[model samples]
Target: MSTQYTFEAIGTHWQIDIKDAITKEQSGELYEQIIKRIALFDAHYSRFRADSLVSTIARAPGSYQLPDDAEPMLSLYHKLYRMTDGRFTPLIGQALSDAGYDAHYSLKEKKLSPPPPWDEALIYNYPTLITQLPVLLDVGAAGKGYLIDIVGELLEHAGIRNYTVDAGGDMRHRTTAHMPLRVGLENPADTTQVIGIVDLQNQSLCGSAGNRRQWGNFHHILDPRSLTSPTHIAALWAVADTTLLADALSTCLFFVPPETLLKHYAFEYLILQSDFTVIMSPHFPARLFTVK
Candidate 1:
């Protein structure tokens, strides 16, 4: 029998099937490493997680010098700043916190209903590692994906030749079966109903649009370009070779118009629309999936 290792890692439980040569204790040790890595990533990078180092710095003023580990992600934050044309600004944390997501998912009493005002973002200096205003930063959009990347890298480095690391369903996967990973795409509107499934082998797959930021069918995939929610499209999933690409791309693609997205990203796609139609990228990995 193919041995299946099942447990929680990176905030999501997993079931990994391997050839019988891999022992249960070996799998258990691997899982232990995975959790340690998750804790490490959170301590260094997460903005929503209060116990993290970043949050500690954010809570402190008078210019706190960042540790060596935070320096790399600080570099990524800069890169993401440039790449997204300021749409993916880490300063959105202030906006998110103003909405009452402090310490947890719970928002402030007035946080839920209203929209943020335009042009309120603080000008952050990346190279200088300083902020001009009191910005409440939320890494909710990117931190989890970063965690997945780190875990996947660990699995790759440990000679776990074929493995998958999923952080709350955001996956960095590599599989061997002449096919991709058999993954179910959870509907943002109804978490139980998988809108579709995809195969992810030697690729990273992330679900961020449509069903994710939702109430009923309407959701929060707001386009920073237009500063409005996208219409008609029900869901969007992106597959790429890197977690950062998958994470950042998902935010924009889920929020903006299709034509606008085409101009922005050259990646492949599988977008589900309102009329029960599927619009896929020219080279989307449809060959990997079994439509059931």
Candidate 2:
């Protein structure tokens, strides 16, 4: 028999579904472990929490040493920062807060502040992060995906192979089953409608929409260069071998076109433009719905 558990963390709902012959007690134990693991990630990485490591670093000046757990994400951000030509940056945390997404999670629209120059904003020496200017570091772009992967690793360590870790729109699955999982792509204009479906197995899929979290004229996804929400793409979805890559790529695809991103990354994507037209990568493995 299969079992499913749901919990809230990092400002989003997390669902873990295990397709296995597990008992109620075993499932309960697994759920508790998952919750603890997610909580650890929140404590270290969540910018919404004032006591979080990321928040402490953002509020302080000069150099700070990150914990061992943050090394992977920091390295990933550095690589993405260069690859996307500053399109994806952790230094946009202050810009996001100025845009009204602050430590309290308030949604009210606020004044837009231009982000510091990418070249002179900060310095990263692996485990040590040094800031030359006043900058807030936000890793919300890929942090959730990284946490999802961590949860998946926990499951694997516990001998759970056929399971799915879904954090809101970010998802990761590993299964030996014969049936392919069906993932619905929601239309940004209408939440109830599915614009496309992806048949996935042993893969990760992450979707981001500019309309999901909006306040006044502001959306969650902001361009560091303009300090404003992007108007070109309404939503995007990416499938990759790792949830971290998929999550980062989904946001990166918003600023950088799929054609340009494809040269550097190996992933399939689907994008819905602000004009309501849908476009998919040449190798997008999803079947689009004709009527949407």
Candidate 3:
């Protein structure tokens, strides 16, 4: 039987089908519109870019008001700041720049060495308002997911329920009774290949491996506590209800040990040890586990 295909948006690979309720021409047009919508939302919501409104707030020091869209994210960011006891912080911009990674990515392809991890240099927090200076917000991990959430909302409002939004390596899946979605886990030692697989149904997944996009022996996953590259685990796979949580969890949980993860999160986990041993949460769906 021929399989059904769902339209995709926001630079994510489209898992579309020639067979759908809408005609081929209509689907193509809708996809194009979605892409344009993605760009519009990105320019407005980005906090890292100097052109964004949040960046304007970051540049200005005292008592700055924000748009409604930015208020929720900025508010939640502060909450995360308190939750991890400063472990998962967005105020490491200066530290990241001083240590290297000043650019969007390493302009010099194949860098000789990875720069050091960033520290939250300074913060100003009150009941409602919070501010930070000298720290650049590299929300690369979560910002895209945030975009996914926004775009997903727009798509849903447009009466398109069966679709997916993937930004970079992060993806959010929302589909009808199509075949189950499958995502592969990359080995931190050699990320070119899939080390494992996970089943997906109306879910979101993000991978943070110390192997791919490396800086010599150093990888992108940095430890906030140690102020250096992560050493404990090879890669991490996190699944959650929201892409925001999935993205942040993938980024923050990578720094701490598995024991710390077990202590805090009640959701499923798939962690790869430095020695290649796998640690999975008790609730992980058995059908998804790949035998390697």
Candidate 4:
């Protein structure tokens, strides 16, 4: 028996499953803790929130201390920023806001300029971030995945062994029984149907696309350099040992070729083109349905 908890937080929905049954009292305690932890994360990172640490950074250029848990996420961002030739950047926050995906959900586009270079915009040294200029930092690409991993760690710390932490479809699953979780890959063009299915066990899977959070001529994923969204790919997904890598790669694949990232990471991927053609790693571990 499993107990699943569902709630909305950090601009998305979260569903966590405890594969092993627990007493009602235990479940209640765990749920409370989860809610509190997610709230803390939002308070620190949510760009949409005026009270968030991200907002504080946007207000002025100064050296600010980060939470103890910020090292992993910031480290990954730094690596990805370098690996993707500045395409995948936290500095894209201002451009995204200009495109109208702001706190107001205005969905109105304004003039946009390329974000500043990563090195010039800020300096990230674990537990401390120094902003050289007033800039908006958006970590939407991998923040959710990192948070999922955080929640997963929380469960493990509490002695829960079999569980899954899913936030807005990006998830991390672990099971002592070695049972695989079958997940469907949703079709961006046709959300009512799935393009394929993947059997995930002891791994994390993340997908990204322009279908959601879209505006007149832009989606959430915008190129920091070109200041435009890629029209070639419709959707993409990645599976890796950690949700952070999977989430970051799903976004990175939009800008760089697989071979470019393959040199740095170990993972499987599937990319669906706008014209309906598919590109996937040979060992992607997913069965796709025919697209007509």
* Number of the predicted model whose lDDT against the real structure is largest: 4
Which residue runs of candidate 2 sit more than 4 Å off their true CA positions?
none
Model 4 lDDT at residue 197: 96
Candidate 3 off by > 4 Å: 1-20, 23-29, 44-48, 104-134, 257-266, 286-292
150-242 per-residue lDDT for model 1 (tens digits): 777777676666666665577787766555678887665577777666767888887765544344323444444454456767667788777
After superposing all C-alphas onto the true structure, candidate 1 shows an RMSD in angstroms of 4.6
Model 1 misses residue 9 by how many Å? Answer: 6.0
lDDT of 2 at 60: 61
lDDT (0-100) at residue 20 of candidate 3?
24
Clashes of 2: 0
Candidate 3 lDDT (Cα, 0 to 1) = 0.58
Model 4: colliding residue pairs: none
Q: Give, for candidate 2, the lowest lDDT window spanning 10 residues.
A: 109-118
Worst 10 residues of 4 by lDDT: 119-128
Q: Candidate 4, which segments miss by more than 4 Å at Cα?
A: none
Question: What is candidate 2's lDDT per residue for 36-82, written digit by digit as tens?
Answer: 98888888887888888877777767888877778777787888877
Q: What is the lDDT of candidate 1?
A: 0.60
